[model samples]
Target: MKKSISITLCAALLALSGCSQNTSSDALSSDISSAASESQSTASQEESSGSSLQNGNGGFKVEGTKLLDANGKEFIMRGINHAHTWYLDEDTTAIKAIAETGSNVVRVVCSDGEQWTKDTENMLETVINLCIDNEMIAVVEVHDATGKDDKTALDKATDYWIEMKNALIGKEQYVILNIANEWTGGWNGELWRDGYTESIPKLREAGIKNTILVDAAGWGQYAKSIGDYGKEVFDSDPDKNTMFAVHMYGTAGKNSSVIEKNLKYAIDNGLCVIVGEFGYTHTDGDVDEAFIMKYCQENGIGYIGWSWKGNSGGVEYLDIANSWDGSVLSADWGENLVNGENGIKQTSVKCSVFTKE
Candidate 1:
């Protein structure tokens, strides 16, 4: 769902440095810049692999800019985001409903207690198993860091993932650990770069090896940051299994040229990326959802819509389904996103791991 901040402020400040729910200080930026620059050479030395890295371990791995499933087949995500933390009761049925749409993935929202109720390890395990049972890959993410520049909060979210090792480990074949959703509200690339560059190693050291997914700065709308320093973050992982994601709202998706340029910047740089979250219309402005889907489909890039249900705070329209059971699909947003041209139904292909040999 679109952030629940003041849209008026966002709209007024849209042209100037873009709109972010929070702001960062120059002192913080300077400190991060110094720390992040120290690892520049080391990250640059690690080249992107051109061959599949699956290794028969039954886990998703990155080869260049492509995401290969456990079977070593390229898997392009086409799915929707589910607010599982906000609507925990819906998990058992919601996941099954989402799978019925022919989606190949589902980005499940979890909380680290920074802003919402913390989802315990048991709850996370349940959500993950539900996706696997339905044959859909689960992209689990912590939502507390959305649109915030506080490194402590970001680190706390990271800690949450490390603590969930019991639930995440050994499920690499079925899970993607999205570090945080829309972290670092400011447009400072160095902050986004340094923060993740520092955090990636912590996760790897702690033994959470699922392909880590990192969102762009400026509320996940700033793709230029990924293009500028994404390689550094990607290389920070000893496993070289990190993937970048950009959330498309009005700021980044207002037009076709902006959308294509943002996406191509990372792709051209040999980085694996995906549209982690997007909506047709947003508080910032109207989004070119059609072009987003069309471009991703044409290029073998992956995309997931904003949400399945449970949107509020003046952004309820973003909900794709009117009911948790998915019995009634919202007229335009839900229907078009799922069944319309270049939508998930037409483009999503189940990962080979789910098919019988």
Candidate 2:
């Protein structure tokens, strides 16, 4: 009987593992408690800041099959993922701090099930506002429950994305929609592909022609998943404005080579690529950060930090910087955001790197 129960538990674990890890739907760490309340108001502010970049009218119209900036210069994402921005419910201050790093893009994430609220639309607008207010770009991530049941999951996903599309149309420059965060489908390409394909027509119908990035299966750490994804995207004939995203964390037993390879694949395949999430907390991790940043900068790829606040499995909160327990944040895999400057030294950068600077 005990053996049967153990087998059942393991099977359940395997079943749950197929969903995206970022959408765990688990309780957030304590740090997010106070921050949750403010995230929603700020979330709506995603592109709210871009309006300020406007000319005589309401900012420049940003219509691009590909992402080219106002000057037609290339704009790539080199930024941090604001943790609990949706959970804590507040942290426009962190957005301001991110701008100091010479970064204009931020991956703003909300914990699971937060999007069902009408208030989410308002929050998204506000967050977009703050991002643009800080002259920063926002990569909006609705990292939420990806059901184990494929048909139901895909249908439910379509519903959620349609809502986001409705709220995000007409806004330009300050926001890009990342469909799901850290897909850990455990090799279920069918589910990922279906979810992505369904979203394109719906989003387009809603007038959201902006760049939409889709993540891969396998905890977002697998590179080969890109090949399958690339195939599916081609098969589905998705809107030309599609990109591929991957998340990475080095110390969490991830393979970095896959990241580099997948990034190349996405770029070579005529799709924009983004390291939607990464965190840097170690000294040596600086080198990796520099390489990825420089490569992405040169190649038009994008990246954002794992988080801004002090959540575990993420970089330390701004107050702690790259140190945990008063020590360096360690050689953990995702240690780039807190220290990715790559020996580029300046007061603002220094301030961003150490949190206390």
Candidate 3:
């Protein structure tokens, strides 16, 4: 399900007044600063899309905190997450510039097949160029409003993801498929249990050998139940490529207890875990991002920020005046404010805690 209206969060997300930072932002100025070339030789596009998940050599291995290249090199993915805006925007020089900033990967958002129009495919093809030009990896995802643990929905979404994945098969050699965005099935456990198991095989059979990311049920709000199932499915497969994902909404969970427990169990069981999403929300009094980031770094877990709209998701909500925005990161942390707006652009090509620290 999709809606065009503004989404004010429940009490947890609604406590925005405390958002340390406040300001209108053309936060993506970096993206706008420099533009990418729309001109790519047809042959180059064909070659990249032809490349497979399996790298030069077969039998993929783990990379530094993320999936390894097929050749067994520990993959270090520096990247961004594009939750929306594809079909509508045909030209994205800023996107390529994002890759240039040193992000080795990007997570592209997708709705179930219902939203895949001819335009979407074209935009996706261009994204392939952005990834290829920057030598970055790609993560494709499904975004449903009220995602249930329904097979029909999962299949449709998976199909949509594959179409994008398949198109880039040869184009970008390093693309991963994320099962769904957060996975909220009204907190129904059994339904999730049955649905995920079935969906995995379907994706695998499609030649999607890239390690897939599965989310904790309840939009990653309930790690206990979601973690339990993650281990079960993982243990059953006997493979090391998959990872269990959780979305971190500061105070959204009962406590850090949920995250702490999930991390411990995933480690003990030898299954990989990642904080697929989290932002500046004051989910807990502390904002909790450092915990998740710190834990991931210490434990070899991978993390992709909730977003990179001028890095505004965190900065804007924190009320940090983006030095560039001058005013501040805009209040529309999760929504779009302007389409035609353009100015100062992304100058940096790479980002990460390891680098910053």
Q: Which prediction has the highest TM-score against the true structure?
A: 1
lDDT of 1 by residue, 301-337 (tens): 9999988988877888888999988999998799989
In candidate 2, which residue ranges exceed 4 Å CA deviation? 1-66, 111-119, 146-151, 164-166, 234-238, 251-256, 280-291, 313-357
Colliding pairs, model 1: none
Per-residue lDDT for 1-357 in model 2, tens only? 001111001122232211001222344457775558556645655444333332111212222213444333345556666654433444556667666556667677643353333336766778777877776766776554332324454445456667766556666445676665644445566666666676666766766655566665555544455655765664453445566776544421123444466576555555556776553332112224455565555555666655554553222322223432223433443234444443111111211111221
Better of 1 and 2 by lDDT: 1
TM-score of 2: 0.65
| Candidate 1 to truth, TM | 0.87
The digit string of per-residue lDDT tens for model 3 on 1-357 reads 112201112224322211011235342334433323222333455455313333432433333234555533345343446544433352254445444334456666655645444326666666655665555666767666234555677666667666655554543235566777655544555666677677777666666655677776665544554545665665433344566665556543234554566555555555566666555454343345545555555555555554544333233353212322223334443221111111112111222211322
Name model 1 segments beyond 4 Å from true.
1-53
Question: Candidate 3, TM-score vs. the true structure?
Answer: 0.65
Q: Which of 1 and 3 is the better model by lDDT?
A: 1
Count of clashing pairs, candidate 1: 0
Cα shift from native, residue 186, model 1 (Å): 0.8
